[model samples]
Target: MPKAKETVLEIDLKALEHNYHFLKSKLKPNTKFLAVVKAFAYGSDSATVAKKLQDLDVDYFAVAYVNEGVVLRDSGITKPILVLHPQPVNFKTLIERCLEPSLYNAKILKEFIAVADAENQTNYPVHIKFNTGLNRLGFWESDTDYISEHLKATKAVKAISVFSHLAASEDLTEIDFTKTQIKNFTAIADDLSSKLGHTLWRHLCNTSGVLNYPEAHFDMVRCGIGLYGFGNAPEYNTELKPIATLKSVISQIHKIEPEESVGYNRAYTSNGYEKTATIPIGHADGISRQFGLEKGAVFIQGKSAPIIGNVCMDMIMVNVTGIDCTEGDEVIVFNANHTASEFASTANTISYEILTAISQRVKRTFLH
Candidate 1:
């Protein structure tokens, strides 16, 4: 194995297992769990996370695209994989790989039904997504009749589950809106179940939903961020262990004088003589530009070193004054000690963006 060097993303499989079990415990008995591993398992390595979840006996895996499902299949994951935003073009490959698609709209439903029929597939599971409130994807409440009619007409396609996404399940301030969404989804699910005359698996909760809305657990729950640690709620933070940490080594150290400029465009000027350390991580490695010029920081010698000046493509300068840091010193950008959520908040973004936007070029080291 390559030794730890410049920038590395440390993945904690043990924490992943812990989060998985924590979320699983919140679900209703006999209810299934779908591990959402899309976007490279939220940019931490999908194959590794999926394999771990599979070993943990997760009932299903969900991805946002067919290619993501393909990744799981290639990794020898035998569990059912749900493609949330599958396009018609990948229908053939999806069937060949035994990957199920989430048919959201009439167009997708009709196209997938035709493809299934042509492929001689029977009871090939596909999910139906309803637009309860997110308004991002899924069929509208009014589109239910058309969807039902098409499903009835297509004998080849099988309705595996009916699901919706929560718009603001994490925001307690939006509890009313979240309740409205739940009500809408429940109404739509009831209508669809009655019309189909057969019960299909129902789910509408993400990690936040699993935590906040146990009454709406339905038949299954899809978990993404919760599995990676941050539960979108402050109370659950202590229960869930973060699965990934961004660490880098100090590449160089420099002495700065009072009134001296640092980094690009003189974004930061030293207040006095100070020691600065340059770390081998930057926007190219997923540290956003917004983190530059005092917005972001790294932990060194158990002390916080505020980032100085603009973040470069491959390097970030930190004011390491009064610190004993030297070249090759390990610096933590974000970890269980310094949560990614804090960095994200500094950047005016969410932890999901921070995790998912991590560049693929960085080295990943898995730890148990």
Candidate 2:
């Protein structure tokens, strides 16, 4: 296909499939797969990514909010969707769209129960989130009895799964801590399931958890970053394929003499005559201003061109000095080869931050 847009995020569906199959292979034969498509599928295109995963027979989809799940539903995504952080205001809408909520606290559980009862809903599916060690959302272990009592009394909602988040599942130095979290979650989930008088799907593994802690796979495994081609670890990273490529083109070029600076605040000044190429992307396009000269770079003509000056809202200059490139030549901001992990580390951030920070205005093209 011809280039129809100047700045575009190319999503490789084949690579997504590769990532899905690769992660799924780590789970037990009976274990279910829930693909996280929140944050616009890590800034790729939630609907497109979810549709692809749906075609791959993924057991479930997860988003951070009810509106995201509604979007998937509107796009005809029939697979079960779990809203990780549902608000009381959207509880009715969540039910209307058949999206399950991860009831992390008593307030959410009570509020959702009220809504479900008011709607005359019965045996509604819900996921229970345990605090474990994340200490963010989720209920405390002591709340299990309360939750079970409420479920038994109201019968308004049923717990289909019990899950917890690992705070340091990616850190090898925190292996002991991760084990502790797993043990705590297992104990809580088992107790809750027993009180409820039925089995509950227990899952506590994120991408790193899936790779490093196979023993915690439980009845299902939730894979997020790994499905988009990052393991947060060197060994596992080598086995995955990045599915998003942020690409732009050289819109213009400038030759500046010594003492001339580029971008806002004169953040970068040339000591000698320099050749620079301006690309049509910047902070507004998810390239953080922290990636100024000497920090991050873009790939052009297979050569690295250091970013020059502060990233602007719509443009950035690169020190292209000796690069054999011209106006309109493709410049890869980040992709599989350069890797978002390497790119984001330049700004002292993680790959998740960089990937999810990509702007929606950047047109997306899917490659099958």
Top candidate by TM-score: 2
Candidate 1 weakest lDDT stretch, 10 residues: 1-10
Model 1 agreement with the true structure over 17-54: per-residue lDDT tens digits:
99999999998789999999999999999999999999
lDDT of 2 by residue, 216-250 (tens): 99988889999999998899899999998989999
- Estimate the TM-score for candidate 2: 0.98
Backbone clash tally for model 2?
0
Whole-model lDDT values for every prediction: 0.91, 0.92
Query: What does candidate 1 score on TM?
Result: 0.97
Candidate 1 deviant stretches above 4 angstroms: 1-3
lDDT score of residue 143 within candidate 2: 95
User: What are the RMSDs of all candidates, in order?
Assistant: 1.6, 1.2
